[model samples]
Target chain A: MASKKDPRTPAQIKLAKQLGAAIAEARKKAGLSQDELAYRCGLHRAYMGFVEQGRYSITVATLVQVCSELDAKPSEILDEIGH
Target chain B: MASKKDPRTPAQIKLAKQLGAAIAEARKKAGLSQDELAYRCGLHRAYMGFVEQGRYSITVATLVQVCSELDAKPSEILDEIGH
Candidate 1:
């Protein structure tokens, strides 16, 4: 369960999910598995799965690495609603 | 040292610092101490110090909590460059 009264609203969750969808699409476009991307990003494979599932709340550092591994920009990941 | 090649860039770091400053300012405006904010935010006091010092990378969860403790919003914390 997430902390209630936190900054992430339903809107933010929706946005995060949208961002995760974008990341999954990008990873597919680049022909990379979740494990491959996680390795490239220097994160745990399970963490990558959580990211894809929108189960984990991420930091800017994680965001940068994931996007870098996927050859993405933060804006790019966020620009499209669902990819 | 933090993770190299991490998502946090000089720009993102700048933004975070600015955000931290905004949070500190808001806390002051609300007349709360570091300990008080930390307690209300459910974070460690030392962690709050690191956040204020811009030495720690934070998660969205943490962001939500800190901002909430300050009676602030994500946009409010970020919209002001420094205040």
Candidate 2:
């Protein structure tokens, strides 16, 4: 049986972290804590923490939720990456 | 054990489909087939099909891969979602 292991590449991991940092900065600028933002976005606090820490591979849908709660545009958040 | 069902909302599903359509448009404009794009991105063709069909909740990393293959930006693809 072939094992299916899709480990993220280093570049992918770095990108995730960059995205997380961007989200954290936006959340702070909006005066929201991780838990508070998570609650407002209907996400689990721990999951939100993971998202902020760049430990989770976030979906576009989830990104929209977070961006909505932060009152920030998706482009604003993504623009922070690769910069 | 508590069930951990994180079903996507209708809005999320719609957004995913929109994103998918945007990707398909970009890919076509770039003159790349789904399989060719998938091959370049190291993704399965079947999975690429699902992504084009907007049937999958794509992760940011995967989105980056597809965008890279399409020579497009994340913002460009996302901009098509809510319009």
DockQ of each two-chain model: 0.18, 0.45
lDDT of 1: 0.70
The sequence of per-residue lDDT tens digits that candidate 2 reaches over residues B6-74 is: 487889889888988899999999999999999999899999998988889999888888998888988
Q: What TM value does model 2 have? A: 0.89
Write one digit per residue (lDDT tens) for candidate 1, span A1-83.
86555455675576566657778899998899999999997779998887887766787457656777777765445335421
Residue B33 lDDT in candidate 1: 96
What ranges in model 1 sit over 4 Å off?
A1-49, A61-83, B1-9, B81-83
Clash totals, every prediction? 2, 0
Q: Give residue A3's lDDT in candidate 2 (0 to 100).
A: 62
Query: For candidate 1, what is the DockQ-based docking class?
Result: incorrect
Candidate 2 ranges beyond 4 A from true positions: A1-6, B1-6
Question: Please, what are the lDDT tens digits per residue for candidate 1 over residues B1-83?
Answer: 87656455686677567656777888899899999999987678998887887766776557656776666765445435521
- Superposition-based RMSD of candidate 2 using all C-alpha atoms, in angstroms: 5.3
